[model samples]
Target: MSATTAPASEIQPLPPAENARATRETASSAAPAAIRHYLSLPFAAVLAGIARYDSVSFWPVAILVVQILLAFLCDRHIRAHERMEPKRWAIRYALLSAAAGASWGAVVVLWFVAAPPANEALFVLACIGVSAMEFIARCRFPYGYAAHAALSLGPLVVLLLLQAAPSSFALAAVCICVSGSLILFGDTIANLIAESDKLRHDNIQLIAKLSNETREALQARDAAEASARAKSTFIANISHEIRTPLNAMLGMSQLLDRADLEKPNRDYVKVMLEAGRGLRTLLDDVITLARDDTMTDNHNDSDPALAARAVAQLLQPHAWEKQLRLSVNAPSTLPRVAADPRRVRQVLLKLTENALKFTDHGGVEITVGVDEPDDDIPAVHFSVSDTGLGIPPDAAETLFEPFMPGDASYARRHQGAGLGLAVAKRVVESLGGNIGFKSEPGEGSTFWFTLPVANASLSGATDDSDADAEVTPPSDLTLLIHTGKLRVDLALSRILESFGNRVIFAESRADAAARAARETFDVIIAGTSDAEMLAATPGMRAPLLAVLFPNDRSPASGEQILHWPAPPRTVYAAIRDAAIRKEPAAAQTRDSQEVAPIDASAFAALEKSLGLSTLLEILQSYIKTAENLCENLAEASAAGEWDEAGRVAQDIAGAASGLGLAALTATARGFAQNVRNHEVEDAHTLRNQAQLIVGEHARTRLALASLYPDLAA
Candidate 1:
């Protein structure tokens, strides 16, 4: 369709202005040479054929001159058409055609009178001219030019050619009409072919554009996801690195508490313990934030109670220090949920800590409940609301954004990174839940999140209200506590007692000295620097023993001390050696060699018991899924779906976590987090690193399993 085409209602008899405009539009879209050749070729051929009739015949010369004039007119019209409107061009062309027709009609009538029964060769030449002209015109403008040229020129030329042959004039007229109709038919076929070709070309372009966009999109998404995963990994690694040393410090301080240290020594130990706890709290927050930032739609709602409990334990000290009331309103028989336990705890603890921070007089409350629904899976809602300072309504939405606080002056009044709500929101959303709040200024706030329950609780799982003992201590060996959380001390005490080990508690070195003064024991276990005071106090009799923290370096002379870089187990082993009669060297060597190489695969039995096989299966499935992801990455990159690619990478990270590929899990988690944070520029390297970790972990696990066959089983 032409741009000048009007509606049917607006369609009027062809006026010169309208026709000229239409012609110009059509001409501008086509090659001028094409239009000229179509219009002039037939006339030139007819005139040349007539020229053979007589060099002296004035009719032939006059026709040749008129043909030259017509050609000139066509050239002028085409040039003018470039500057004029389509309607104007069309009108001019129509006028030119009429003028050419009138002149040719006069020539035809004159030729019939002078040259009756014209040569067959002349008529053949005219026929050929008309056929060639129509063909070329049809090639140029299939719909308009070709139809008009064939209709006007074909029949007229044939009739003019036949006029010279009286006997064949009637037959020629009939034949001309048939030939004109045939030209019209050929034009239609040609138009259809040309249209189909144009359509195919358009379709190819559209598809190519779409594919390119899809690929670009995928690449961008992958990049973003890779960045997020890197961030999560960094958080986890940093947390672990800090935690190891913190554990040692806190442990030693706890041992100091048991010793009979002077007030200054006891106070110093307490300060160190508090600092270590503070560091732990900070690390936990970072980890939670990282995990939350990397979460996606497919994130599981089930989180381990043990892990979540660990986070809560970290914040418990902070709450105690503040002297704020705190209570966990979890169901007596709360079910586990399919969520990132680390993230969930982070969110809850953040809310609790925030509540405690602002509430000088009120207590913080946390409730964990399940909503019964028609579906098989139950929804568990955990709400941590506090009677602390409430959030302004206007700032509610922005509060979840990083660095945006409830009050602009909060930084001056309270000390925090202002990431609590942001982290909480991200964590909740990641765990397939929502987080919301209700608060009034100067009143308080309530923050809540909901997730699906992982499984029904066992009857006895909730029997131990104070967190069930997780670590089991060895029996037949004397145990000593140096320093650590009260709960850890309590748990360790219970575990050692259950194992039939004699357990002793001392707040300072002086206390241990008093115990030693009264008994001649097999071993004396010292927790911290209090060992110095304990050693100074002349013990009655016992092989002196000291329990070293993971990073503890100080040593007191005349005492056998061991640093438990591997913690409790190694500490107990050292105590056993120091307290009991030494086993034969050969037996000690055998024991040491027996437990070597307990790597990832060695824990397969435990893994399966914990239902981690599903994770392994997912890892195995990654070979296929990853292929799809890669393909999707390419497509998304081409399509410019950067966000989608990031999501895909996150999926891979989560799957890696299930397989117990911690390193890989960290890497993927980092990438996903970075993407979510809009840190995409660094995505490429991160994603590659993440993939490598996953691959390496898989191989490491398999190799370890191979070395220790029973471990895998």
Candidate 2:
């Protein structure tokens, strides 16, 4: 057993005989029994020193010593020989205790068989000590230790009681019960702690992984936004650069004379110039849309009329070129709304341009009306309706999306990238408004939108420029003093002069106030910006009319402040209303009450003929009819009911067509034509679309009430 040689029991061996020989040879110096009996050293030594006791004590102690020794040796043997399963790693240490516990069971049986208990008290005491250790082990390895404890203690307690050792029996039973309870309690606590540890470890790992993933996602988002911004900047810069040179080239070309050149040469130059113009126009539209997308925080509650008039004036040529009648109607005292004038003008121009482009026979009309104040904030609604090639029923809502052409074939017929509506929609939404359309395939479409208006009374300025200067000069109308820009003053003056009215001019607020103090004037027509200063003068009872510009950043003081976006028309209307009024106009007047009602007879008759008297009826009928039409169309396409489906569509079309419901008629006709031509490909989709077209007619009729007012209840 030298340290250099190592113990013989620790050596590896092949056979069972070899293993036993090695174990014995190592223990020779100590005692050959020492290697063979590892755990029994204490028990064996104790027994050998003690005097012989009663058979009860002797047998139980001897058996217990033998099993403990055997258990220790066997545990060493198993560990050396066997490998553990990775999957069972959780109970690796516990498994060793479980194997040791098996030897306890063998000892219990041997003790009972060797000698029946004479003094059962001694047997019970030995049993109690052994079982307690077994129970502790059972808490580590539930099944193995449980078996050992039960066998070691169960029979000993029973034998003690049978021998009239009731106290010993009761004590043994109590010890067993406590041991068992401890084993169960320890096991539960161990398992709960293990589970908690496992969950905490997993949560820490998950949090680390999530943090890494979030960092990656944020980085990607930043890169994407940066790339988008760069691209937009590049487009805007390049477009502007290209347009600057392109504008010069086109202007020079236009200056070249056709009279000095051959007809064909002139035509080639003209074509090239026209192509450049078109490209420039496309570039301008792209830049505008891009600018609007990026621009922020430029809101002003100013004069809206100026912006509206500018857009109308810009688009007038386009409308006139197409022989389409265009008119603008803005009220005299429209509440100033917070908006970007350039963007607003751009939106209006785009809509009007689209209307004129598509319309061949009918007209485009632009109307700006101030809706009654809601929530102390009035809204100004701008409507652009046109008689043109109306939108397809299926394409109306999609019209505002980028690059979505209604008819691909008609794309060449119209020279546009279909970005007009897209740009307009974006601009309107950026200004806190919405853009929507109502159109039929043939009759035309009306696009309407609303924007917030600044309530007049909330504003600080008041128009009291001319209160004192008065001569009850004539029964006929006469303008004592007029103040406006050149174009506005001249236009208003010419209009009044045509009606045999006298006119005076004041270019600025100072001049207008001076005229008010010195001379007599029947009425004062001044730009809205100067109206507040003029109205503050004494005895200025003559009605004050304001001429507002598109970009004039003045707040509306009250309804008395006329925000005539179209200065000419609003000025004329105001002058007429003021002159015809029985009492002198108040300092603040409410919004005009001269709203025209929309005609409902046509709508009502159409509804009645369609068997829909109310909106509910209309909606229900639409749903039912849509469902039935779709089903019939689908079935017909499958069963070759082409002629019947075509006839049904034609009938529907005829009814809609006669009533000027162009959108409905167009959809019905498109379906009917498809059916007649045996082109009922995807009939289900067409049927659903037909239902929507019919439904839109009902919606449009209802929407007209708000627009036309007469159809309201």
Candidate 3:
């Protein structure tokens, strides 16, 4: 079992510390098996000596037996204490190996000297076989193997050389070569064992480290998910709370504007309303940022031109206040775009407002038109160019990061939360569009974005009533409307009257039926409940327009339905279509008077300027004020104090507008109007007002409290 040395290149050397540890482990592991081999080999030697007993003495046999007994003792000790340190065990095994080798050498020397010259070759062969067996057994421990090989063969070699014969010298030289070869082979085998052991140790350590890192990574992921959930809950709750009072304030202010006040007071109310709306806009931006996922839905066909025009109108008041001209320049024929009209309006509002806020001298111009096709999708381009202080080069990199304004100085003239561009960028990107800007400091800036055009088929299907196309109401038509709620009735009446239409109101289905029997109207508009009944009424000759609320079921096929809370233009378009039984011709001009639910920009500014603590206090104060006003309103209404109720509604509108709660403000404003018109005498009318105000307040409070749990607590 002699070992052949492998090529040095095939064996990788281990570091000194690792090599030492490897060697100790290898030796300890091989000890038990090597001990068993030692015992067997010595037994074989003893049996051979007995076979040659006629020619040799019993001394050699006795020596072999002694070596076997020693091997047995070492094996027993190793098995009994398996937990013994490798290095200490290896040393003890080496000593046992030395003793075994010396005993074998003595037996060989005795036989060689006693045997005849005829048996000299047999003894030499026997010595070589024993040396080979020793090498195989102890090779894993090179030092121990080397000692055994040399000791076992040394006496035989010396005896042969001292004979002074050529054959004897040749035999001695062969023994020397065998000894050297076995020692070298043992060393090579030892290195291979060391490298193997070191590799295993390294692998174990690497696996442990990987497991630990994986555990930490999982923990981090869990923590992140928890934090995300908490953040989402907070945003939803805070948004509701903040919006409640804001709506109340804005609604009250709108109602106040309608009161017979002096010009100065009217002007102040207008300013307050505008400021409140602005604040609501800012709050919306913050909410949008926190709820980024919401922006991904509702991509519908929209007119880029109309959206641009609406933005121009919405900000025109601000422009007028700043004494700057604001105009929208859109192509007469622009393609309908694939986008969310609300989001588009939001983006435009942000850009234009930023432009208006920054510009000190020149006007802001909004341009909308078609751009070169991209990926075979036609796109509509919208740009807001303002003669304001252009963005600085240094601020360009972080300009689109939320709360990072172009002018970040604490004393900067224009105050903002710096979320306009950030929000615009996010919205455009989420809508599958690109947004960027070109600016020269102290000169002006142009911010632009592009939305893909709507599919040709969709655009063509509704081509007659193009979203950008205006539809003029038939001023000479006599319209009869079935009234339900006071607010809806008043709003619809005012809208229809402004267009020069002679409108008659029906209080119930019976009244509508009666009115239909008497009047020959061009168009009959009724709430969803009375639409069918009025249409079946005797002597009814006019086309029916059903006003559907949000929760209303879908109208029957071929039925003309108008969604409530629609823009005035939409109402006119519906009426014109119902009256003529065809799409109305596009008018030259149109105006949008719709108000947004919240103003994101103003809210952001308030949040940034007031710090979290101060803002929290403000929110707390607003909640308290709103609660008091709600109680005051209920008391005033119960006492039939119409004037006091109107005053209370005005106060709520002021508070809501200041906080940018547009929806609540609008509701409160309508409630106040109903009071002023003495329309709250009816139980239904009074109940409706109370429900609207209370519902809005509850929503606002819940939203705010959710956002700031501390406030709720």
Candidate 4:
């Protein structure tokens, strides 16, 4: 007889208890459909037995009716108690199936023994059909199918053999063969079903495991982002807190330098100033590290040669202090590169600073050139080579990691937090560039990086030979600057005095007007608040260069204006331009209909100076201020209060300029100009007034959402 169970190797075996439960469940669920086939068979057999009443007696009919009742009862029991006490339930199911087979076997035997030789073949055929039905119904359970086949065919084969006739013996032989074949086929079917179920279980487990892993990965990513945000916030707040006192110290040091003190005391103050500046530089490096990757994409076309020259100029004093020759070798006509000028300057500054710090005797050289073409994208290459102590072999791998200096010994001569190279690497990579170095121990190190050219065609279009040329204010020019802020006064006095110009401070608009009337000054510098009043003063002939603050108004006339906190060189250039221009340039007009919502260059400048968190705070403040000013402007305009409207418009313009909202700034400036000139009654000026109010709200919202998405949310 075929084995009652599948081979163990053919399918992974479940635990004994689970195997039993699975078998019972599969059998129970299959029982309803399996029993349906037998249900009709028992009723049909009873009808056949009645038609052959002479040969098959009432006993056969009674047996068929009993089989029908047993089928219903077994189905009901299987359905009601599926998977309950699986081991006992499976045994009971097999026994019931076997009993049903035996009942059919008894019917077949009784009919065959009573019938004549001619009808004996009919009974044998009936026995074979019932045995086939048994195989079909119970094949999924090998033990059940085997028991059913053995009991149903066993009695028929024996009775035929006992007849002692040729036809009866042949019939017995056929019954034995059919029983063996059914048992073999049923075993194969059972093995296949078992394999299918095992595969299903494995797949379910695999899917569950994968789902859990994916969920964990997402959680880890979110956690990492949150931690990064928190770190950035902490660094920005601390940097801002430190800068306030640091600035005061540096400013005091500058004040001390101007005081009449002993030589030793002067040297002491100088050292204090240098130390303070160094600390401030380290704080800036930390802030740079805290800035997010989004800064990389906020760049405009920049001149590498110009940036290189600028870095050299800024570091010239340090190089002089160290007695090292600092030089820049860059072509004046190099193509503009796709990088932020300030960030480019920062990377160069870090690299050059490191080179200067390490090298004591020899000089540092900066070289800029076009790198070899890479995939048809031209790139500008910049390198800072120094004759410093080259990197040790052991430190090469971690040289660019933060705080990992080339020489980490406590007694190492170099002094730094070792964050310069790390900051430089980050800035370069963020701009989609590669930075690396070549060093030889005890010889020198050459650090290099590449930035993509913004436009290949503009390679030879720019000439920057004069970029580093000093702008000398006309010799011994008398300049009058009107300002109340000490910081501004000190800064301007230093720059103007450095160029050998006489600077006169004005306490108020009236004082500035009186100074201009009496002094015959070459250039008059005053805040925008006093620009208009001073210009209207009788006998005032000096060109008025209006110094604009964030909350200051642009003069209605074609007066020169300079943004506050400008580079000293920029201030010099502006002064030179103002002195030479024979006439006030017609007020430069912009397309009133078109302007960018945010000036990317200006926004980047703000972010670099203020840090992201502080910049966002300023933006939030500006949004609130702009909204209120817009409301005030509308009210004043409706009341036909031109002076009040003009003041509000100027406030709006200043606030817009501070946040780099170009569209809002232009609209508000035009409205302010219109109000100042008493043109508010005209359609054009009224339209500009409406635009200023509407554009302020729209532009500020856009700036808030784009620059600081977290706060916008």
Best-performing candidate as measured by lDDT = 4
Better candidate number, 3 or 4, judged by lDDT:
4
Q: Which is better, 2 or 4, measured by lDDT?
A: 4
lDDT of 2 by residue, 273-386 (tens): 667767776776677676624556366554444455445545543444444565555533456666755566667777887788778886777777776655775678888888
lDDT of each residue in 7-101, candidate 3, tens digit only = 75466444434434455555556667766776677556754554444344556667778767877775665665455665676677678778878
Clashes of 2: 25
**Tens digits of per-residue lDDT for model 4, 357-425:** 889877899999999986888899999999988888888899898878888762145557778888988
lDDT of each: 0.54, 0.54, 0.69, 0.70
Q: Which ten contiguous residues of candidate 1 have the minimum total lDDT?
A: 463-472
lDDT, candidate 1, 1-713, per-residue tens = 41134333333334435434434544443445555664564456456446435424544445646645765666666766577665555555656655654554455445544553446446434544554554453332333433444444444456556557664565456546654554445434443434455576679999999999999999999998998778777765666567666666666665555455665776677677656666655555566666734555343333333333433434443444444545444433456676654466657767777877777765676667776755676777777767777887888778788767788776447655567777788777766667787888888888777776765442123222222112223345554454434444554565345435777776655666777778555566665575666666664556666656545667746577755333454455555556544345334332211332223442443333223444343333433444455555456544555555555555444434333344444444455445544566654655554444345445544654564453365
Error of 2 at 478 (Å): 40
Off by over 4 Å in 4: 1-22, 25-87, 99-141, 150-196, 333-336, 373-378, 408-414, 453-455, 462-713
After TM-score superposition, the amount by which residue 455's alpha carbon in candidate 2 deviates from its true location, in angstroms, is 6.4
Off by over 4 Å in 1: 1-276, 291-324, 328-346, 372-378, 392-394, 405-414, 453-713
Please identify which of the two predictions, 2 or 3, would achieve the higher TM-score against the true structure.
Answer: 3
The all-Cα superposition gives candidate 3 an RMSD in Å to the true structure of 19.6
